[model samples]
Target: MPIDPMLYETQFFGFTPQTCMLRIYIAFQDYLFEVMVAVEKVILKKAGALSAVQVRGSTEAFLRFMKQRFDRLFVKMERALLRLVLSVPPTVLLPEDRSHERHPQSREDFRLLQQDVERLQGRYKAELGARRALLAELEVQKAVRAQLRKTLRWLDGLGDAHGPPGLGEMMSLLIQHSGRLRSITEDVAQKSSGGGME
Candidate 1:
């Protein structure tokens, strides 16, 4: 920003301050795109299916607005920068002008850009790790549910191959047990009554 456009034009042939500013603008645009991509991937990976769809829909709408706004800004900036570049007489860039590419402001901007990339990369890595854990937990739950279902089905299949016992079957079992118990109780009573023919 400190680089005066007129100063650069007089000093450098091809490289202009406006060109550097354009590149900075381009970097900002690229940064936004990168962030959007990372956000989309994280949302898709982290959210449930229904929530992900909803989130994606809303995010897409927001992204459309952002894209439109940035696109307009870019077009305007490009037009102005290009006009300035064209008005300036074309000159051959010197070796010194090449060093100007590392201008302090540009260097600081690029440094911040790099930091942003690194930060986003870290977020993506963490999201992927969390997703893996979530998937593993889901798999375990699915396996447990499958086992439970199988056990329930096996329990339901107990008794006979034809079908489970009905009320009639339960009543029959109860009657048979009661009949034996009754006979034993009567026998015991007869013995306690001295076992003589009564």
Candidate 2:
């Protein structure tokens, strides 16, 4: 007896093809999380080695190693995700496939599938942008903190002859600067949360 493509499709892709596609998408997401966790462990281990480096050359070597590790991990992650996305049955489904046309609802189902793929892509791009912004903001905050500490140290060196500012005055200035920093932080957070593609 000959095999029927429609029967095979119904049996494997489910009555509603979209449901099967969503199941595959969710599975890929779960696999991505696992890969990320594994990469993070390796990154953390590299980060730990940084603290023990006393020499400048050793410190530079560790930094280079960390960067290389991250670069390789990112490349591997991209390839893996691309493979998973491409391997999805719906992604490979042909518009002219007669088996897919067995159900009159297939067109609408494919439209919905396209929309979901677009949404997921937009979300992934937005997340990547947000993370980059956050990292830049954190770097700025770290520099600002170092400068604040230096200023405080310099203030402490000023003797009473200069009638060093009262503790209250110093604290008031610090509070003003802190408020500005907090405002910038909040703005970044808000933009990241609301800047998703429509």
Candidate 3:
């Protein structure tokens, strides 16, 4: 049960202020050890003389005085209990999830991972540049092949006309050079294909 409204209760038969105070003291010692300190300060101070006067005085006056004392003690105890209940513990914290907590090891690992990624990016760029250079070389070889075909056609025309004294030797030399250029073009094409670039 909620204990706020539960003040000290005793039957009127053989009721006395000494009995009531003793009951309160015993209760304090049992359930509220520290609250007993407050009780001594609040209720039990000057209690001996107060109880003597109540014993000689009217029973109604004694009842009123005892009720006032109980009320004051209860109020103090309630405040102490409420402060205890409502107070936050020192270790308690908001945002208890620690999955993303950054320790030194994790941070170092992240830095190393970033470096590896950057190294891979640099290698990829270098490979791309090499591929572009190879493609340019292939284009140059194609142009050379086209030029050699035109020259062979011109040499054939010259042969039909039987022009010039060294014309056949020049034509033979041109054909041999054309064959070497074709072989070089095939080698470059094969190298480009064998390389891993797309």
lDDT of each: 0.68, 0.60, 0.58
Model 1 pairs in collision: 13-91
* Stretches of model 1 off by over 4 angstroms after superposition: 1-105, 161-198
lDDT of 3 at 5: 26
RMSD of 2: 32.1
In candidate 1, what residue range of length 10 has the lowest lDDT sum?
189-198
Clashes of 1: 1
In Å, residue 90's CA in model 2 sits off its true spot by: 20
Residue-level error in angstroms, candidate 2, position 183: 13
lDDT string for model 3 (1-198, tens) is 554321121122234434444566667545543544455545435566566344444444644576578678876765564345433344543343233343335778899999999999999999889889877777766676676677668757865686553867777867877787677667657755654333
- Give all TM-scores, in the order shown: 0.31, 0.31, 0.34
RMSD of each: 31.9, 32.1, 21.0
Top candidate (TM-score): 3
Q: Could you tell me how far off, in angstroms, the CA of residue 198 lies in candidate 1 after the best superposition?
A: 82
Which candidate model has the greater TM-score, 1 or 3? 3
